[model samples]
Target: MRTALNLRLFLAAVIATAVALVATAVVLNFLFRLYFEDRLRDELETYLIQLSGNVAVTDSGEVEVGPLADPRFNNPLSGYYWQIEVAGADPVLSPSFWGAPMALERPEQPGVIRVQDINIGTEEPLAVAHWVILTGQDAAQRSLHLAVALDRTDLDVSVAGFRLNSTLWLAVLGAFLLIASAVQIRLGLRPLEKVRSEVNRVSRSPAGRLSDDYPTEVLPLVEEVNQLLDTNAATLERVRAGAGNLAHGLKTPLTILHGVERKLRKAGQDLLADELQTEIASIEHIVERELARHRDSGQSRQVCEVAPVVRRLSDALSQQPGSEQIRWSVEVDERLRAPFDEFDLTELVGNLLDNAMKWTDGRIVVRGALSGTVASLTVCDDGPGLSDAGHEIVLGRGRKADPERSGTGLGLSIADEMAQAHGCALTLDRSDMGGLSVMLAWEQAEAAPR
Candidate 1:
């Protein structure tokens, strides 16, 4: 199946949300890590400043460690350490170092601060160092380097936790947004769905029209469709009116010609009179064909129940002279519908039944049933069925199996035109009754090929 528009839009929204959330999580985590690194540097710099002020050179020319402010500096292997180095004396280390010598990079100049990573054999820490020139008792300047270190394990743990929490919350937010997008898409397009349903209804019923109660976005479209329908209806009406007027105007002249033919026959000029009658009959056939074409155009899109229409046509046909003698059997379900206008259905069936009545000796049957997307109909008669070549001839305009019949031979041709108009296939073949069988199969109007 083709994907629905709303579903495609919703999927795009979901994918976009997921990508945005992932990007947001990555950015937030990165920014937080930078902030944490700055905080670590500031803490290390503060410790380094305090250590510089506390350093001293004794009168014995030996370096001595003073009482430190931070308790972690006094603990063994506490992961926070301070070390002091002098240019001409041994380096002094804090108790927290546990005698593990940290390789620290010296600062570039005096009173200048530097931050670097120091890795002992077992652990890595961030170190901040500063170099200072101190004046001893002899007024000699001694270069002192003070450095403070802190382990990065705690910062890493904090960042990992923040990242995990951010991902989970962002995933939840994305799901909520997907649900909201689905609802919004459906609500936004509900007006178009309404218009579709109403348009379908109008196609099935000629009297139906789309209402103006639509969203502003769809109002213009609905108005244009309604106006087009009105224009088509008016145009069809005018054409049919002209056809009807033409038929009426020709009928009087044909009647006068028939009178002239009758007079010639009474006056014993049968050969010329018969030739004139044949020509007049051909003219009448053309008029009937034109009228049938106009009648079919305005009735193609209507929907009607098959059984009622068949019964109504059968009842009307039975009132005619030869129709009463035939055994009429109709087998149609009441619910079996045909996608054809009621009048069109009557005309299509009437032509077939009228021809059957003309040729049948006793029995005629009309059967209708729907299967899948097709409506199947069969009209059978107990008459001398035509050969393959005759079938083609009878379906042609003004061709009859028997010239003795009163018709102008336009019945099947008109029926063929009606079938084509409604996207139906009509066929003639030998029947079970040892006679002619006419079959019509049409798809549902929506599925019909235009």
Candidate 2:
């Protein structure tokens, strides 16, 4: 499914943050439990030492345990206890002793002790004993020792209270962090949101463009897009203005010619009337060609495929009159696609070829070849070539190079404008066919070539 860019970015940040937090919590929780358990073990081991110090052998050889001095150690219900004993007699238990004297299988060995949910009387479900035997003493006189059981019912209760309180506090912190993450995501993405809102108001119709000032990160993109829109708008506006101006400017002369033709018809001079009609038709043709010039002024410089346009033009030209009589050739690599519209590029090449065909009395050769950074086109005609003045006037507005040099006077001008729009130029010179060889030298950028 398609998602908003900002939303996806926000969600990705949230997920990554959450994963990091969970990983940290797990690691820290394990460490806390490990350290806390160690502390509890150390406290139990310290109690074992305190109890041992109170034990002594009497003169009659009976061992006696003195009353524990610490108030907490004396309380049976406090969940802590100890046992003192000398070998061979019933083990001495504290008055607080609430369990059976231990029957340890390993005889009070020292190290890790494992005992589970053993009952210690008074309805206690949890009790544990840490027993150790003092070595290097006589067999009859060795101290059989123990660090007595914790009520653990109370220890468990304390553990439950501690874990509950810690969890509640951690939950509150986690909630705050989640809310903060949402706010942070919204705050971080504000600039891009502003860009979207700005773009929403722009339109291509009235040549509208984006104008919002984005953050430094997005500013370049916004600026480039706006520039492209502006360039396209300017080009389209120029074409519209040029069309309006050309229509108004060329119509006046045609109107005058029409009036002159009417005058000649009313005067009834039949011989001269035919000549005037032909001249008027010729002028009308020129006016149409000038309109073509204005129409061809727009060149769209988006990604355009050159091969398709060439193929389309080749097909179109084949259908034209006397198309088979001339040798037509098109050469382009598969990657040499035109950057202009298929129709626009086609119209440019087609017009140039049509003009060449008109002037070529014999063989006409048209070919487009590319070499590295430059693409060149040659439309050679075995017909009368252009004179010195033809070069200047061909590119000038509405003026023919040679008044006597044939065809609708606007063809050369249309050809020149098309060439410039397509990023090429027309050069007038002699052909090997003893006619005009118009060499078009176009430099295609390593970037998109129009």
Local distance difference test, per candidate?
0.82, 0.63
Candidate 1 residue-wise lDDT, 1-450, digit = tens: 899888899989988988899899999999999999999888888888888778877766677767778899888878888888877666788887775566666665777888876667775554455555464645655667787888887888999999999989998999899999999999988998999899888988877789999988899999999998898778878987898899899989999998998899999999989898888878988888888788777566678778888899888888887566788999975656676877778878888998889889899999987666777889999899899998998988778887777777888888887788777899999989988999988885333321
Window of ten residues with lowest summed lDDT in model 1: 441-450
Candidate 2 deviation (Cα RMSD):
15.8
Q: What is the lDDT of candidate 1?
A: 0.82
TM-score top scorer = 1
Error of 2 at 20 (Å): 4.3
Q: Where does candidate 2 stray beyond 4 Å?
A: 24-28, 58-61, 85-87, 105-140, 204-209, 238-450
lDDT for 176 (candidate 2):
81
**Residue 348 Cα positional deviation in candidate 2, in Å, after optimal superposition:** 29
Model 2, span 1-450: residue lDDT tens:
999866787677667766766676666666666565565666665666666667776655576677766666566556666665556677777666556764444444454444434565457653454555553446444555555555555556666666666666666776787678778878878877776666543531234566656778888988987887788668767876776787788788877876786688789975676577567656665665665555554443433555566667666876788667766556644455443555456666676666777776746676566678776666777777777676676655545554455544555566666667666677778778787777666665553445
**Candidate 2 structure lDDT:** 0.63
Candidate 2, run of 10 with poorest lDDT: 199-208
